[model samples]
Target: MSESKKFSVYLMATLPIVFWGVSFAAAKVALEEADPLLLLFLRFAISLPLLLALAWRGGEAALPTKKQALVLIFMGFMGFYFHLGIQTMAMRTSGSGMANWQMAASPAAAALMSAIFLKERMSRTGLLGALCAFLGVTVVLGLGTKGAKGISIYNFGDFLITVSMLNWAAFMVVTRWLFRDGGYPPLFTIFWEVFFAALMCAPTLALLRVDVGAAARFGAPTWEALLVLGLLCSGLAYAFWYRAAAAIPVPRLMVFQFLQPLVGVVAGYFVIGERFTPWLILGGAMIVSGVYAANSHK
Candidate 1:
């Protein structure tokens, strides 16, 4: 790719990371007033129209084959329905700091899964950069013994987050598989994925007895957070992610995930009075350098 094209690809990839980074803060705000399962349902419900519209506009909105439908449904369930729902619930018990700190492991998990299943390999420099990025995120998040303990019976939420991380890794690999040889455009695939996620979540809402009526009581801030989560994070961000993942190697793209926690910390700083320290500066530099190095050509 030319310099300009590569820059655009990187920029496109960054869009979702930023949306998801701020999403931790948004979910916190919304969860203060809404049930976690309700929040998850609303996220998918609100985003569906937008995704469908986008896919339709792009002229890629054809229905999938039986096999494609199955894969897309699996993607929807694993990626959005299960992963996001579990993560949201986990945050209620464990808190966003713990969640973000644990999420820093996702990129490494993704890279490993890509290597194993997709037969993708990163160069030595890329691996080094990935390690550096991972360390940067650990510093930026200030993960300590409190949250980093290996999962025990008491750490149920932590265990759930670990599951979310692994599920995310598998989701990335499956998405790459769908797109590799020939598949629908990102928006089209994302639309169907989210469609099935929302469809599957509908029954769960009743099984869990989530009060859908609670939405009537949502305040302006709560509604605003929901809209942002739905429209931007779930809707546009997923599309942007799939697009980038389709075009870029999974391992190389996974390196960019290291910035997510840093973004979350910055978002927290502004939204919730989290402090900015010297660690932020040092860690931010390492993360940027690592992403550049990992994505650089041999």
Candidate 2:
């Protein structure tokens, strides 16, 4: 490839990861003004049209069957509704850097879940890596936060983020099952997931008796953060990620994912003034290495 072309390819790969990394801080910013349910509702509601457009561009008229539709609804709820809602709530107490570090372990979680649920074989190295990742998460939970007094006494915010990580892993396994038949186009399935998730969020907000109109009074920072979360992180970043996946080798492209935590740390520091502790660095390094090792077997 020419120098310019190579640059473009690397840029394509890097941008999406940057968007996603910054998303944790963005969510933190939005959470300052709005509750988790409202934040979740705004995110999917804003991104829905963009995802719908991408799905329609595929020109696939075949929709999911009734059985598949039910499955999709469940997937939507698991992946977006509950997963994001819990994570958003977690952000109320967790630092963006800590959230990113915990989430970085999710691939290991997913690999273990796949081995157990799908009967997939895991290499010894993969098993060790999974163990290392969980240990790293424990270290983070024990040492990463400000209020935690000791290993046994953990921050509630960190605990919620850990739950979010496992929930996401389960969602991935379910998504793999849904896509295994190759009946649904990836974009189409994603669109429906966001669509159904947004639909579910509406009733949730109503149940919570949240003042949806209160969002109009939010300051510029909150709106800007929400726009970045909705438009760039959810919409364009996903589209760019899929495009990058098509162009770059999967393994080579995955190297960029490791950069996500670093980006999150930088973003958290600058955007939210989150501190960079030695323990956070040590714990995060363990997570990145473990996830890298866990995924290496594939």
Candidate 3:
């Protein structure tokens, strides 16, 4: 890519990372008043229409084959439904900032999977990076021992955040598989993914698990939070992401993501008063180093 184009790609990728990082705080705010499932529903409800507006423009059918459709549905369930639900519940207790850095294990886990299934070989530096990433996890876990009495290795929310990151890595693997043969536009694929996610989540209201009536009690801040989550975080963020992914080389594109965890820490600090602990700083640095190490082709 040309220098100007690469810069544009970086700018595009940065948009979603910024939105998603701050979104952790938005989600925390929304979760204070709404159930995770309900918050997810409202998020999609706000996000989907806008995505559809953009995704279906110019009269494109952009339909998928039955198999590809199944893949998309499966991706939605794993990526949006189950994983996001876990994240929502976790972020409620974990707070946004620490929850962000807690996800350092994802790229390392992805590297392991690539080695196992794809037969990819990791360099010594890559292996070291993975170890550093998990070492950061240990550091975070050690810090947890200091905070809450009688509980160590962090809270359930932090654990769930780690779980969500693993799910996302699996989601990425499957997405890459679909990309190999799915023959769909990125936005179109995203639309269907969100569609299936919303479809799966629709029953949350009638399931009696959540007080669907609670929506009636939502005040302005809650509404505003969901709107931003759905509109900017979910909608435009994904749009920019797909555009950037298409524009940039995969390796170069991925390197930019290391900034996300760092951004999340800052956003979390200012947005929710979560402090930057020494452990967090050290752990996050290790994780960012690992992400670059793992993603680097050379």
List the pairs of residues colliding in candidate 2.
Answer: none
Error of 3 at 131 (Å): 8.9
Q: How does each model score on lDDT?
A: 0.84, 0.72, 0.70
| Candidate 1 residue 266 C-alpha distance from true site, Å | 0.6
Candidate 1 local lDDT, residue 17: 88
Mind giving the per-residue lDDT tens digits that candidate 2 earns over 1-298? 6667656766776788789889888898898888888998999988978887877786643477898789779888888888888888988878766777677666656666766875555667756765665666566655654543332335898899899888876776666555555675667777777788899988878988999998989999999999998989878776666545444433334445555666665565676565656777776777667656755543
Ranking by lDDT: 1, 2, 3
Ranking by TM-score: 1, 3, 2
In model 3, which range of ten residues has the least summed lDDT?
143-152
Residue 68 displacement in candidate 2 (angstroms):
2.1
Global CA lDDT of candidate 1, please?
0.84
- TM-score of model 3 (CA atoms): 0.78
Q: Write the per-residue lDDT of candidate 3 for residues 18-121, one digit (tens) a residue.
A: 78777788888898899989999888878988888888783433777798789789888988888878988887678564665655445556555655654545
> Residue 46 deviation, candidate 1, in Å?
1.2
Q: Point out where model 1 deviates above 4 Å.
A: 143-154
